[model samples]
Target chain A: MKRRDLIKGAGAGLLAAGTGIAAPAIAKGVKQWRMQMTWRANSPLLATGPQLVADYINKASNGRLELKLYAAGDLVSPFQVLDAVADGTLHMGHGYPAYWAGKLAAVQFFAPIPFGFTSQEQNAWFHYGGGQELADEVYGELGVKFLPSGNTSVQAAGWYNKELNSIESFKGLKIRSGGLGAKVLTEIGGVPVQMPLGEVPQGLQSGAIDGADFVGPFNDMAFGLHKVAKHYYWPGWMEPSAVLDCFINKEAWDSLDKDLQEIVKGANAMANQMVLSEFVTKNAQAVKIMKEEHKVDFRLLDPATLGHLGRVSQSVIDDVGQTDDLTRKVYASYRKFIDTVQPYSELSEMAFMNARAQLKS
Target chain B: MKRRDLIKGAGAGLLAAGTGIAAPAIAKGVKQWRMQMTWRANSPLLATGPQLVADYINKASNGRLELKLYAAGDLVSPFQVLDAVADGTLHMGHGYPAYWAGKLAAVQFFAPIPFGFTSQEQNAWFHYGGGQELADEVYGELGVKFLPSGNTSVQAAGWYNKELNSIESFKGLKIRSGGLGAKVLTEIGGVPVQMPLGEVPQGLQSGAIDGADFVGPFNDMAFGLHKVAKHYYWPGWMEPSAVLDCFINKEAWDSLDKDLQEIVKGANAMANQMVLSEFVTKNAQAVKIMKEEHKVDFRLLDPATLGHLGRVSQSVIDDVGQTDDLTRKVYASYRKFIDTVQPYSELSEMAFMNARAQLKS
Candidate 1:
């Protein structure tokens, strides 16, 4: 048979097989999807990323696929997103993989690790360095298809009421942090507290927490952390480049035709690029406002402290990876890619920034 | 009249008028387009960027809008791409805006400037900092629609036969460079020569050029420059982040439906992100190969030399911007965005990299 005849035969065979699947829904004109995000309505990059994804997909598909977005608590709680999407409570979910670290240890690597890859490097690892396959292997078992939909560049280290003069400063300090960052902080003698971002401002104000590491300047400014914290820190070492994921019900994904699938992928890719760029611009503007207008003191962590933290971070990552065999496999792949990308980054980005500093001075 | 009746009336009036327009093309199922690229067939990021854009559009449109890509010299010629696309000789073209410096001096700022915005900063500026509006104003007059399709992250400075130990080394030295970089070289007393990338290896081998700056390690390795040049330099200060452009014929663009237009835009955005990520991976691997297998000597341009070059680069940019009103407008906007983004980068990306270095040691 010719190729066209073979496709026709296969199509007829599949249809005649009486698989009561997505065919009926697809034929009903516009397919509406409900997507739940693990972010507040006005969350900066997190909320905007999913919103852009929906806009892009809707515009590109010409109403063929209409996705309605729901902020956190609209349908289900934030932490319940994975289970909700997996069980088909929602067609999709927008969240960070690290949020599900309690259930799957390897998920943290897929989100962001302490002292992990930067935004550019992480995207590279995801698309080209076998990351997507490894991610599929992990998320596949959960019955959800994973797509990295956005990035919040390198986050700010945190907002601090007191200066971090040395590694000893971390001892007995209460820090509002989550995911692997919390683990690294705990290893370094700091008390790590998990609280919703909404509570961070009050937590710092009430002296419940000495510091907090949120998304970045843009989101931190939104939370009014700079108003309470006098000193803002540099380089969010815990979550270097935080990635936001779009988790689709595996059944929903499998049901889509090739064209709809491609549209969804393209939309997610656009969102991934757009959100990072938006963060770069908005974060810069927010920093200027915080520093010049709000008088927030920008401070860098001392070299010795950073060095100590880095060492502790590595140990934390190793421990987390050893929890299961799959985590170990994913962690090994992540490490190898990071090692491979480091030298080039040193020669190019690192060297350029150093040279730029000299020029500015 | 009712809304539906008004639309029906307008449709009837237009049909009665019988204007010879896009009706016939809409009746045709698939719209095939030809796109030309200003890169060799085997070029890494440059060629791949445009090819991916074509692939994305084809797949997303379900072959309704098929784009066929032509490499450099395959059609008219590399330099004639802009003109060809504008005159409708080709439906689309991929190139750098700096290539059109002779026609529009302001165009170089849109592409890459010596010591200008980095990859992340540039994308932010283009999307958020009034760059797209300014770009539209410039390109609209030329009857083409411009879209930023790809980026080559920070490039390696160059490969040299001898060491660049001080500022004096640039004086009277023959360097193969182009665009703003060549102008900066001229200001710093170097005799900048414009040569094709293919001829760089032979030029260096024959002692015709002392050093050459190419795209990063990946493309540089493909050109076999490491075989002839022993010393590899860090931080391509000249073209910090070179962006690739996709130029579509205005007439061709206007003929498409809104959905198709969005698909094109999303495809270009996807290409932009994917290409940069691809470069990060490939360049890292290439650096490793050059260092281990080829034994290329890695060197940093001394602080004093870099500082002096930075000064001259500023002067070149300032002079270039003063050429016309549009150039000045773009230059002002570019400068403002750069200033806004620099502080955040210093606190985030720069600080993280520096802290990372301390830890590795």
Candidate 2:
């Protein structure tokens, strides 16, 4: 019954002209609502996961709630999704919390910060470690309901052109990165360019940027970054595990009946699982193909190199985390969670991984 | 909208007498179907996750379908769940695939094997990597529909009484374990004792077993293993990530309308995510408690000993995998998936973990 059909993007998702607003209307006997996502057309992990959420909600509601999806720039730009959803311009919008950092500093803490929580840790924090309560307090101020919808499990460090033997190798290099990772690069005297993922391949080939860390192998390979940059790197210290969130206007969310609300919540959780699985499965396949068929040279940043970056990352995070009162509270939670979970994760999953890796040829 | 409520196991889940048959009866204009689980009443990660699945299905269906849940031995024994579901004695059941290894050796591959796929990788394999198709072929023979419902993310190496410095330390010692882990223990001249997880604490206290590999810190701590054994070890090489599945009778599954079927599938996926997140969070909290409050001595098994265990494990798997044609096919798929996923996982998440661990105080 489960099929991996490519989600139709652009106009195909809606049978009727969408108002692109939060006010739901009763069409015949069904309730109609519009949803938008911060993803371009045919984007694999980003768009597909949200599309599944919309699909699940539409189907599981059994003609009660009909949710139509739109891609990034289909209704508005990716960065404006939060404001659009909050102001009732869109019923619901799916995007990364990091995209709203410029508007609210506290939101950045919810995104994947450098050397921060992994996907598993992030999920645990959101559900168990008082994260949802914190989210309610922070995002609730903007009249938006926040839900962790999807995650990009541990992205690749990125694609590179020149080999890195030292921290000095990063100086003056223009790299397309985002958030705390970008700040760390800036601290190291590298130019951090903020550009969309789709433009990265051309940027690297035409010398617009020396390097880029858009996403993991699956997404990076889709952009044809491997052809432009032979030295592909791993352990994306930039965004270890990015959590994608689904934002809904508080009024629109409150307007839904109890059963419809439950359907929406269940759809978000299902999409979270589906998104990570897709990333893990596709990244594995992509890496094997890039390595064996495309002759991409996969490189690891040495421990010393990573250590220097990690130090810079901590300082950058400290500056951002201390910007305001809400940011401080969120950072405290993140700090305690990481302090509690990291040691245990290292002993259990990380130790198992080291042992398993050695067993392989 | 999402809340974590303790699942009412045993009698509380049903309002009326359950027929425990696949033939759904109409009750107050709602279709009623009964489901049983391998978990006992009030089990944390195990029963709670599956109960949430039932709750989601119930609420999302909006009274169209009412699914009742039961705990282990409430309707039938834990080991009988598969057979009960297959024969339509139970409309649906939830349990690990390894429980039915005696009935069909091929089903064992679907469970967590020694040093096999991690939770993320396992999720990937089940969804992608042609695993579900293989499941349809393998489990379709048993008149049951299989869906991956939950997972225990990478368990601990388990608890031990004696310090493990060498392979000989395990010789002639009784350890409560099961599946391929038990087989590996037997290969190493250790007396493998099979018992329920709830019994591990009493067995260790009574000197019936010297050590036990019941589960990770969360469940094992719940069994009061920390009170029995001081030396808690790292990297459970036995069952890296065990996947718990929801099994539906072919007849019952086919009887559902398309919308109801989607609800069922969506609930399973949500449970899968919740289960792993609970494991990750609880294990982290439990380990911290065991160390600080209980003063449990956390230990690491040296790589040389793990290497030896891995070697025996492969041989044991080879013997079991070669037992029949279907098993061989399943084993081939497992091998291909691990070989493809492991290298990339090692370089990405594992590498980032090591780097992050080094950064912490």
Candidate 3:
């Protein structure tokens, strides 16, 4: 199957070529690799990362390298995204960086820290700023090379069972949060539970946790979050911009031809955008359904509680710094960067908000 | 047209309501004016912005307030989002401050001054660094109140027609570029043409322009730039991190019920992630098409030319500074910001590239 032949087939052939199955055989007479994503087939980001890259490389090299993708749970469990990619069981995995934080503290920053950067800023940091370097350094230590695969802008706080009238309401409440947000929540007196996506609905139903936080309305609705937790909270300050990753085995990545490497990067970039746009269009319908059809009560954490959480977030960062040297380096860099820009944000964004609120009221 | 009737009809109705047709009818009996957006239909940021005050006023008045979403491109072009909302064209427009650089010199800095600041650092600037004050002063002049809607990550440079080999190739070339990049390209002796999304392909096809630049692969592919141009470029240095906005008409926004304002802001927050993620996923396939079918050439501009362009860019900025106070203020701020963090970018990003290229050869 020549590269042109594989491409001509389109659809399933495109899929097959993308995941690396018969692509190399049919295309450029090169090598093929397969990656089974942890997200559902409907997930544009998860389904297409490898596919897009494979197609690009196949086309670029006239079929020298191909990658085939398998939907979530097809080749491995969803939770295995990072592990599969890390151990070379899979060539790559598309998931959040924080999922691998246990392996490296710096991974969490790649995704989101409490009250961290938004998606746009994070991308700038990683791509143009010193972010990708830091990311590469951290992940390189573990024999994995990371590509930023997805970025979810400021997210909703989470789904709640009731309104948060004050900071005290957080005490004793059990909620599911990820990355370093769990630590922030814990600091604010809430009990934090970390669970995989598959377990969320069950957790909510069985009362294992009081509430949960996921990507946003599109995913939340797709996962039927509104069905379980009726009160959706807002201002996901803890995870303002959630970034996902495409973790490829370093050896496997380096082994690819130059064209193949470019393809992989190109494909990841495509997947990142698709996921972002789909959510933009689809989430609206989903949220509307949840609000009107299902009667979900959406709420924002009280201002006081939000402020308290922000303070707690600072302590959490400090705590992480105390616990790990790598964490200290990343956090220190982040802190210094934050401090330099703090005055600007205060005068520009904060002042406007304060002035507007008073004048409007 | 009633809120109940609209909600009962669902998605399409909400979309229609967003165009302002249904808001009046719905406002008759609604105690709570809630707005949904395509960005994030019912998120909390909406409530915090104009909608929050709208809700308050509606509540105070006992059911006369109706808040609804101003979906992307609902009342006007998405690019004109901020202006529409600010000038009371509609109660709100999804404000992407990054897009308004043409109007105000300083707006770019407030958004993300190309290759500057990570998302976290941006938030720091807006919240604590006095950036917010500067941004508000700008927006205040425009008769609008602004809040962080959401942010995007670093974007790709753009799709191009041919691989650039040397600085000479830029001379007499007409290409599609925008914002500060137009100036940068102009400095390099190239003619930079600005065209909205609809006009790019025609410009490319008619040779009205040699190439064009836009969001990233996700968006570029959607427009099928791969089909028109054979070369795709990278390192979206011009718009390292573009920020989207949720614009509100000062007077009308101020008049909105409180909860409704928060709804708008919250939805913008939600939109932020959706847009970011969409770009990530979509670009993969677009680039694939470009590589495979279009046989698009992927090349980075030669370092000498890139360096030359960078130098010219400074001159352009300097020239802008000589013309207007706002331009000078913005340039000074931007220059100071860039100078402060450039050492890090140099040591990390540029240095790594230099080291890696040596290793590559």
DockQ of 2: 0.68
Q: Which interface RMSD values do the candidates have, in the order shown?
A: 0.9, 1.1, 21.1
Alpha-carbon TM-score of each model against the true structure: 0.92, 0.93, 0.48
lDDT digits (tens) for residues B1-361 of candidate 2: 1211233333333323444453445665567776889988678888977798789878888877788787887767788888878876677888888887788788988877998888888888887787877876778888888888888888877788888888888999998888888899999999999887778888888889998888788888887888888688888899888988888888788878878988888888878888887888888999899889988899989999998888888889989889899999999999899889998888788999999888764
Docking class for model 1 is medium
Ten residues in a row with the worst lDDT in model 1 chain B?
Answer: B18-27
Error of 3 at B295 (Å): 52
lDDT of 3 by residue, B91-150 (tens): 555545656767776675665443345443454345434555666677777777766655
Error of 1 at A257 (Å): 1.0
Which DockQ-derived CAPRI band holds candidate 3? incorrect
Candidate with the greatest DockQ versus the true structure? 2
Q: Kindly list the per-residue Cα lDDT of model 1 for residues B242-264, writing each as its tens digit.
A: 88889898988998888899899
True C-alpha contacts between chains kept, each model in order: 0.79, 0.75, 0.00
- Badly placed stretches (over 4 Å) of model 2 are A1-29, B1-29
**True-structure RMSD for candidate 3:** 23.6
- Worst ten-residue run, lDDT, model 2 chain A? A1-10
Q: Sort the candidates on lDDT, descending order.
A: 1, 2, 3
State how far residue A196 of model 2 sits from its true place (Å): 2.5
